[model samples]
Target chain A: MGVRVQEGDFDLAVELADFGRGAGGIVTFTGVARNNDAGNLQYMEIEHYPAMTQSAIEAIANEARSRWDLCDLLIIHRHGRLAPGARIMMVATASAHRADAFAAAEFLMDYLKSRAPFWKKEVTSDSAEWVAAKEADEKALDRW
Target chain B: MIDVVYFAWVRERIGLPRESVETDATTVAELIDELSKREERYALAFSDRGAIRAAVDQTLVDLDAPLKGAREVAFFPPMTGG
Candidate 1:
C-alpha cells in the first residue's frame, strides 16, 4: 500500500530501511534528472490524469508482486514543474533475499518507465517540446 | 456510460482532456469510431490510429479488446512515462 504523489524530495535510504522491517534485504532506486544539456532543458513539467496515473502505478506494483516474493514496496513520483538535478521518481522493495529485492526493484522501474501514463514536457530556452516514447523503454519491458 | 480521457498532445489534438459519453460499442475501436464522428478534432486525434493507444478500465488494452463492462476509457499517444 505504498503509493505517493509528492512535491518534495525523498530519501531512498530511509524508505528502504523502513520497508525492510521483517525482511532480509531491501533494494531501492531513485531516478534523477539527467543533464540533457544539449537539449537546453530549462525545466520540465510532468502531467498525468490523476485517477489513471494512480491506477497505472498500482498495476505496476501488482505486476512486481506477481514476479517476485517481496515484503513491501514503495513508489513515489513527482509531478508539475521540475528542474535539472531534481529527483523524478523512487522505488523501494523488500524481500526475503537480496536477489529478489534487487530484481524486483529493477523490474518495477522498467515497467514504470514504459507503462505508466505520465508525460513529460521539456521547456527549453528556445522552445518547448513533449518528450517522445523511446524504443528502448518498450524493449526493456519485453525482457520480463 | 464511460469517461474517456486524453492527455498531453492527445488532449491538444482533441481539444479536451476528458469527456463523458454513452456508447453501445463492445470494443475500443468501435468507441473510437463513434468519437471520430463527433468533430474534426477527434477525427484528427484518431486519424493516425496506429499512433494512438488505449486503456480500458485503467488497464492497457488492444483496440479490438472488448469493453463489455468498462466504466472508463483513455486514449493517448504511446507512453512517455519515466
Candidate 2:
C-alpha cells in the first residue's frame, strides 16, 4: 500500500503498528547493512536514481499485490550513508493465507534485488567500491 | 535538447550528474554514439555498451529504444538494489 525511498532510517515497530489489519498472515523482511570481512568497513553509501526509484518499487509492489490476494504491502528503502548494522530497507506483505503472504514476500524480494535502481558502494578502511551486481540475483527471477 | 543524466560510477567517470545535448540521434544507441565521441570521459564511460543501462524520460529502456520527443535520458550501471 506504500512505497518509500528515503535517507532516514525506519522503525519497524512504528511502521507495523498500523499495518496489516485483519490479515491472517503477514511476512516482513528487513535488509541490514553488514560489515564486509576484513571488517575495517566504515560506512556504506547508497545511491539511487531519484526519478525512477519510487515508481520502480511501486510497480513491483503492485505486481506482488496482483499475484497474491494481498491485504496490504509496503516497501521502504533507505538511501545515504549507513553504518554497519543499520537497517537498509524492508518489505512486508499481508494476505489471508500464509502461503500467499510468503510467496509474495519472496517474489518482491527477488525482483527488488536485481530490478530496482539503487546501488550500494561499500567503504572500508582502505577503499570504497561500487558493489558489483550479482548474476545470481538476476537468475533468481527465472524461478518466478 | 535533451537532459542526459548519469548515475553511480557512470557519474563518477563522467564527473557530472547531467548535461544538455542537442542532437539528431533517433535512439538511445545513437545518443550514446554521439556522446561517446564527445570526449574521453564519455568514451570511457560508454566504451562497453554491456556495462551501461539507460532510461528515456525516467523509464528504463533498451539502447535501441527510440528517443523521439523524449526530453530526458539517463545512463548508469546495472541496478544493484534490494
Whole-model lDDT for model 1 versus the true structure?
A: 0.85
TM-score of each: 0.89, 0.98
As a TM-score, model 2 comes out at: 0.98
In the range A1-144, model 1's lDDT, one tens digit per residue, is 498876677877666555768989878788876657695878888887677788789888998999899998999988888898889998889999999999998898888887888888888888777888888888998889
The segments of candidate 1 whose C-alpha lies over 4 angstroms from its true place after superposition are A37-39
Q: What's the distance in Å from true for residue A20, model 2?
A: 0.8
- Per-prediction TM-score, chain B alone: 0.95, 0.97
Compute the interface RMSD for candidate 1.
1.1
**Candidate 2 docking category?**
high
TM-score of chain A of each: 0.91, 0.98
Which sections of candidate 2 miss by over 4 Å?
none
Could you report the Cα RMSD, in angstroms, for every candidate shown? 2.1, 0.9
